[model samples]
Target: MTRSARRTRRALQAAGAGAAALLALSACSSSDSDSGSTTSGSSASSSSSPKLSGDVTVFAAASLQESFTTLGKEFEKAHPGTKVTFSFGGSDSLAAGITGGAPADVFASASPKTMAIVTDKKDNATVPATFVRNQLEIATLPGNPDKVSSLKDLTRSGLKVVLCDKTVPCGAAAQKALDASKLKLTPVSYEEDVKSALNKVVLKEADAAVVYKTDVKTAGSKVEGVDFPESADAINDYPITLLKDSKNPETAKAFIALVQSAEGQKVLSEAGFLKP
Candidate 1:
């Protein structure tokens, strides 16, 4: 072969090899860009989605039954694979259960004092946040047959009135309202919780019940609610907290957030609980 032809062929081969290398590099760059985009999108998705799952048990005050139950359903719906179980009763009793080592993930009390029973103990509770406030109301049988209107009317002779035991929040608030009006009342029975006190009137076992406004509302047509001015002097604040021994801290925290959220406020307000 002629020297010039050989050189020309060699140069063409070299040029072809360089072009192939460029194409390989370009292909690698494009593949890297797509991989990086996929990685970035996955990261964003992971960051936005909360990691919450597992079972969560909540011990709540009797007054929270309706609202918190509604919220629990919502929380479970919002977070798939999560279960919410509740034990509703007097705040004092629930507090004792927690401080006594009950397996509760969250504690929501009708009164700050009861929440203190948990928060006061070492490693028993997290700092509590007041989620709602409630006021006293007179819950009488439908139509208020006793003609009871004011706190003093409860003092009427022969009226079988029921009040929560003084140790509980409802009872404490009732006492405060009574003291504010400078009126004395002697309830026929001091029930353990507001629900029981309200039940007394509900079952026609008593003439009336001095209970939380929310309780009357929850009772629906079963009872009539009467607001007294003295209730303004004895508002009870409801507080919620995550327990230290929470089996699912993330789920518990999410539940607390749901309770304090605007959606939670709407549910609570609908149930007659005043905003905090």
Candidate 2:
């Protein structure tokens, strides 16, 4: 054969081999999909063995960290073959996570507004029962060192004040308290959460901030909380709901039940939460 003819023949041979390999790959994939009839029978046997053997994630508000963590441990001890994981953050953050496809079995928020964001979506639970009540307070350095009495004092010249942004529940409640007292406070900074606002007071970076009473109790002796009658007008209501796409629905229901039980209220009360 001529040289050109030989090269042409070799190229055709190579192309034929490549085509054969492509055909083999397609055959394998098609075979797998077509084998569902054979695999389906055995799959059910394996699936029937065990169903509840995964983690249950609970997303809660940052303010519930201390109490919820303690209670989470108790819940884990009570349930065998189940693990409870917690993600505590701002209520709005937690709600966003749940509504944004974050895998969570339960959600406990600091306010009805944040909870509504979830309930309005797929996480709604009939009508969420109120779990706890939180009120605002003027947190200052240990003792009346700043001599801060009312919300107006937060804006006094030379008295640095910190507050939460209006997005957070605590900040909204603080705004209500200020509105009730008819006082406008100029804070040095607006924190993302109540804890951050309280931390500025504890660190002495800010002379005062309006935070939840439970946060004050959680701070131990690092700060002092003074009650103002305006707190009554700003009591925040906490509501918890079980997510609809939970991996462990039973565990989620139990957790919600525990939070609404008398024992749960007592725990919240000891942590400085008021009854609604």
Candidate 3:
């Protein structure tokens, strides 16, 4: 081959080698960039909390019905694919249900004693936190016709009165108040929950009912709330906890968080619940 032709051939070979090297370098850089992007994406995904979803079944005291119901609606609104279902009744009964494997995701009791029932059975996932406090009140017929002004007044002769059952938190608190005041009261009936006791007064079936101040506030115009000093001695500390067998633990936790949050406290305070 001619010398010039050989030189040209060599030059072509060198150019091809340079082109190949450039292509290899570019591919390697792209591969590294793609690997880095994937790792960053994975890190971001892992760092962020998962979105909450599913049904959160809450078993709470009857007194928490109004405020908790409001919080439940807010929770559902914040999380589109979530729902909050509440079973409100006497704290004792709700605690009993939780310990009996009622499939509740959370429990908000009116008193620590009732919360202990579930915690002692190891049915709670976390320690119960006191979220609010409530004191007793005299719920009388509209216009204060009964003239029930104090805890002692409930003992007036021939007045039909109702009280929460002794096993329930409200009833237990009422007994404490009465004992503190050195007073005795015999109600016409012992209702199962605070709402029931308040209902009796609201429906005019009884002259008055000893229930929580929150309950009286919920009854609105249906009954008149009379604050008594003896209630100070029997204020109930409301507690809440996540259950161990929760089917939707994440959602349950979120609900509990909402209940204990500033926003939750606002709703509770507006409902006449005292801060813990």
TM-score of model 3 vs. true structure: 0.84
Write one digit per residue (lDDT tens) for candidate 3, span 207-268.
99999988889888999999998899899999999999999998899999999999999999
**What would you estimate as the lDDT of candidate 1?**
0.92
RMSD of 2: 18.2
| lDDT, candidates in the order shown | 0.92, 0.84, 0.92
Each candidate: RMSD: 5.1, 18.2, 6.2
Ten consecutive residues with minimal summed lDDT in candidate 1?
A: 119-128
| Maximum-lDDT candidate | 3
TM-score of each: 0.85, 0.78, 0.84
Q: Which residue pairs of candidate 1 clash?
A: none
Cα lDDT tens digits, model 2, 136-157, are: 8889999969898877777688
Clashes of 3: 0
Report the alpha-carbon TM-score of model 2 versus the true structure: 0.78
Clashing residue pairs for model 2? none
